[model samples]
Target: MLTDTLRKVDNLMKNKFTAILVALCFCITSVNFTGLLTVSAATYGDYTYKVSNGEVTITGFDDSVSGAITIPAEINGYPVTAIDKDAFYGCDSLESIEIPNSVKIIGEGAFRYCYALTSVTISNGVTTIGEEAFEECSSLENIQIPDSVTSIGQWAFYNTAYYDDETNWADGVLYIGNHLIKADRD
Candidate 1:
């Protein structure tokens, strides 16, 4: 009877030990995978924020130079696709901007407060212009909105030379169709 009882105890211990090992393995796998996912999320979209041309790359601001800045059209054989929010914000000396046809989206506040910005040329294929995209550009004079654009968010060009003068839409004309949205002088 004693021998039988000992065998039962041994079997019970073996089963419990196997269950514990399985649980530990599951916990380790869960923790390892969670860590890997967190790292991926942090680095997923980090590459789309800067402008690079292999020969010359520009990002954020140009504290060394005080005058005009020209972002490259291509970077490392890849066409420039995105200009991050505030990429050129507060560039007071920026007199003009030329966005290439390769660009698809201009993030919020991308060109905010370019006090000296007078000319802007947006190339084809751009579909969306984010809010405050060109806000507070007081000196901006000529703006060409491509027909490919479908939506213009609120305050996208607010407090700028385009909308500052309510009486004169001549200074700024939103080009949508083959026609322009202008004031009727009738």
Candidate 2:
């Protein structure tokens, strides 16, 4: 009877240890992923932004404020380093924008479908313009893309006046600075 009782205790202990280990693993994963996915956001002036790694990323805009949208170099003391995906999506009143030199990454569809947007002046520090960043900006005709851009996502300038114009093409492709935005011929 004693032997049988000792064996039951041993099995019980092992099961409890296994349960504890599984619980600990789950807690560790939750802590790590929470830090990565739970970004705190704040509003500064016309921008709603998030801060990570001491830099600010613009995530949303106050659509009521329109025309000549000048993205500031910094927000609330942190340097504005990026623009989030779909940040200004469908802000039809936005007529123009000058992406400041502090910004490096422009997220996918960042300025997509801003129908009234007619001009864009990307600063020299910008490196990547995300997919469909300016897609469907029907009025967009004037733009100055700096040589610093290394990657531009597909349809970044599609449906814009600049993309539709043959004068902006070389032979068949629309080359913006040294980056090939689209190819047109046959």
Steric overlap count per candidate: 1, 0
Q: Name the best candidate (by lDDT).
A: 2
Provide the lDDT at 31 for model 1. Answer: 73
**Candidate 2: misplaced stretches above 4 Å?**
1-38
What tens digits encode model 1's per-residue C-alpha lDDT throughout 1-186?
999999999999999999999999999876744422321111112222332332222235552334554555665554666666887788788888888877777778888888888877888877777788888999776778888877666567666675665554554554323434433322
TM-scores for all candidates? 0.60, 0.78
lDDT of 2 by residue, 67-99 (tens): 888999998778999999999999999999999
lDDT of each: 0.65, 0.91
RMSD of each: 7.2, 4.3
